[model samples]
Target chain A: MWKSVIYKEWLKTRWFLIIYAAIGVLAVGRIFLKVQHDFTFNEATNFWYVILFQGYQYFGILKFLPALGGLIIAVSQFFPETVNKRIKLTFHLPIVENKVMIIMMLFGACCLLLTFGVVSLFFYGLSIIYFPHEIIHGALVTMTPWFLAGLAIYFLAALIILEPVWKFRFLYALVAVAFIPSVFFDDTITGGYSPANPVLFVLVIIMSTALLFSGYRFRKGEM
Target chain B: MVRLSRYFLVIIAIIAFSVVIPKFYWMAFEKPVRSPFVMYSCVENDFMIQKSTQDGLVRTDTRGNNYTREQYEEKLPLMYMRQLMISGTMPDTINGVFMDAREINDERSTFRLRTRDLFTPDPGLYPMFESQSGRANLEMPDDYFRITWRMEFVDANTNKILEEKSRMFSAVLYNRGFDFPAKSINGIPTTRKSIDEGYLVIDSEDQLFHVKMIKGKPFVEKVEIPEGLKFKHISCVDFRNKRYYAYLFSEENDLYILTQDDYVLKKLPVDGLIPEEQEIKIYADYFHYNIISDGEGYMRSQILDADFNPVDEYSETWPVKMERTEGKIYKFLFPGELSLSNSNSNYNAFFLNLNKSINWLVLSLILIVIQFFIIKRRNEKFKNQIVDFTAILFTGIFGFLAVNIFPNKFFK
Candidate 1:
């Protein structure tokens, strides 16, 4: 059952994922090229000074890519099911209704995790070529919140789309939009998320469970 | 389970609303409010103020005498010493104290330390620069050190840990009674200046220590923090005068100057200064120094002679309109607020600050009664009304929005 569900989601989202990956690479590559150009055209040690002491964020160009990718994939995966009333057939399958919802959410999460992870790793690899460990480490920690926000928006967009009522969907959208500011709150501050990281992890867990509640209401036909 | 899920979703929605409504109100309605600038007049031994009024910009002394800009500058001779010197109007003596131009220029330097409530903690790593570089200009070092239970320097070029120098720094700190796993550490690594005063560290026991690299060696000193003095912020002051090592602010809003002398802490005479929200400016001359702190609704100034004696003090205040507006809204809408960040730390954590609750409680009661009538009109059971009422009581406006949006239905 999990295999079929995974395959079905893959078939729906493969093209979108590939396009997002290409865009992510291009965005990240542009930042790297800019840094290389700075090193070449400007004084050599100036790049080191900017990266180290100035708290420059080389990966800021890729900030919105992950969140955009997550939202697109979530909508693409679930909107068709709702439009054609195909979600009802899936709910009536040989399984507990909530498990099916949970499985679907997990599939979206895993794909997003892989997408965000690959992009972050590529950024890390590129950073170490010209920058030191501390610089790369600070940049990665600062970027983690943005990536987590991507996963959060994915689950939230899915919940809002699957929700059966307009008023309730608007409430979900309001809540989701309110959380958007927190993603970019400390993105400019180097290593700013060091203290709030534990709290952030907890927020991610809460967001994942929020989808279950939305799914429960849909299954029970609550207005 | 369905009911539980609804409650869960409602709670999340309320939290989100609590974060958004206040922000939206402020973004739309906030207006600029400026406090008067207060400066102490050394010659007159009185506080002077410059402020905007319905008439125009007014300059007045505390004794109620209005003065022109030139008169105000003449009253603060030492503060306006540079202007006077450049204009060839140098005073021979004022308030019985003669001033020398070169001496004033050489001795006069000011350093400011403002609090950043939402900054990153030290990553325990610092780039150790060579104090006496053989080259004329100081260059960035290739190695950085991390202080854990011990100090370990890693080569930035090769990324290899240097075990020997790491042991040397660890031993020196241990000899000065520095503990392992530091509670907080701060450093000044920008070597654009003439001298390097490496790092200020607070150990696990909250003891302060000064560590610097002198000629590629460790110079460790245990700073003497006053007994029972609880400080909340520390910053290194690399002034050309070299009079003070750093500026420390206590938890009780007292700003202390940590003099270069080993055991000296000069507490500045300023009152009710919120370091996080205030801007401090210090003007120094050979005869006197003027310290001005501007907070949200008020500005305070203190004048001190060369000996740090209080010559005069002055202040002016106006009502902060933003707080008043927020206060009015809190009465109508919310019982309290949930804050994600505080003045001391920028971490995303939950903190509940309650405003006056009686009005909000009354408002919530009225709202819930209206909701009860609506449910009753639909012939819903009394038990179903209980969830909606309790939610309103607990979450105020957010609960009202949630229940209206996700109303419970009963099929007759």
Candidate 2:
């Protein structure tokens, strides 16, 4: 049952993944050329250049890929399954709903993670060539917030489309409003840029949990 | 469920309280006031050999030429720059201002004081000057003076006085150096002579007055000495490959260099420039050469060309010290090959406007709102989505103009 659910999600989001991969490759190539054109041989090894390439600016483009992919996947596939009563057939086929939801969520999340991994790998290669001495350890730590924020936004888009209720629409608006404050208070709005405050980590967790629970509640009641 | 609602209410209350309390306190308590009392100080230098123990006294020059200490005590009633609308017994001293029996508490009690020079208000009074202005001015011996002060402060009860507590002050003025110019070379007699120019003057504490004097006539004056201060010797040298003339003043181990043309003074690193071999002190306006000085009795000097620019350098030793009093001190051991001006491109001004927090916040919020409305219209199956988008865009533009653009234009 889990396999079927995962397969269905994969089938729906495979095109998005391919398009994201293409965009990621092109962006990385453009960034490399831009970096090479701007800096001389010695200056290319500067710490600021490495940070700009591997950190905020690189993550900024990476974040959009997930948001766009998540929106397309949620609106076209996830919503239709509920609105068209296709979820009813799946629910009645002796498959536990939670397991099915988890499978579908994991499939979507994997695609996002894969796209992020590819982009990061490209950046890592550039960093290695240009700045061998600079440590890439901070990149992993920085990318976590972007991943979490992207996941939260994806969950929000999923809940908004799947439920499509007036009251739930208001709740969705509230979720977006909650994110507005994070743009000012947290660095994730600017492509997962951050100062590594623990409070921001708690905020992301709380927001993500709220979105996931809302999705679960909508699935349990409306569909 | 009851507890959950109570917790939610508490959270809302906290947010509301945080937002409202600051605004309330700002509106109720924060009021502007015009500060009273304008205090200033002046230092005079006398270079003549006649004076012995008198090293020239530092005088407190007030804004209104109100110099007498006893008169300042009597006019303490009018010292308060503001008169409040409400009546009460004015405090004797508020923020070190001796207030007389006058008080007021109206909203219009604030008045700013206009500060002016005592001697001559024309061309303005500088920290260092030679002689007094106008023909009938009080004239005396050769000396220079600089004065600085702590200005007046208005009392909370609307009374003001020029009170002396050495805290909460105005400005400080002090004399710097003497101006003397010469057009001829040393010992060689040409048609050139010395110019004795008098610039600023002040009264000394010893009831005697001093003026700044330059030796020789107008065009060939080489030596300049302040009248009252005892000096060991004066030396003049052509520096920076004869681009400018430097007048050196030496007293004991200290050396002061003043330019011949403008009389601008600068202190030289004499100890670092000379090794233990030479006990003589040397001062120059511009030290264009490099000096190698070991602690032992050995010294070497390499004079660079006048057109050579100094190299930029970064220092790791002796961390950059930021102090309010001492200002910035940059210690450089060696210069770098590349200058900062040559390597870095000036940051584009495009980001200058976008760097403000308020602009980005408003833009993001408007975008979020427009996105919300667009999605809402689609949910309602509305055919005319352009109207909603246009309305939101117009409102956002209007809000931006009102909040950011209008106020800046009006205030600035």
Error of 1 at A180 (Å): 2.2
Among all candidates shown, the one with the greatest lDDT? 1
RMSD of each: 3.9, 28.0
TM-scores of the candidates are 0.85, 0.36
lDDT tens digits, residues A98-145, model 2? 556556666666676677688778878775554322224444444555
lDDT of 1 by residue, B191-307 (tens): 676676677777877788888778889988887877777667776766666777777777887878778856477887766667777776676666666777777677777778877
Docking level of model 2: incorrect
Error of 1 at B328 (Å): 2.5
| Model 2 chain B lDDT-worst window of ten | B329-338
Per-residue CA lDDT of model 2 for B73-113, tens digit only, reads 32322222333212232345543644333321111111111
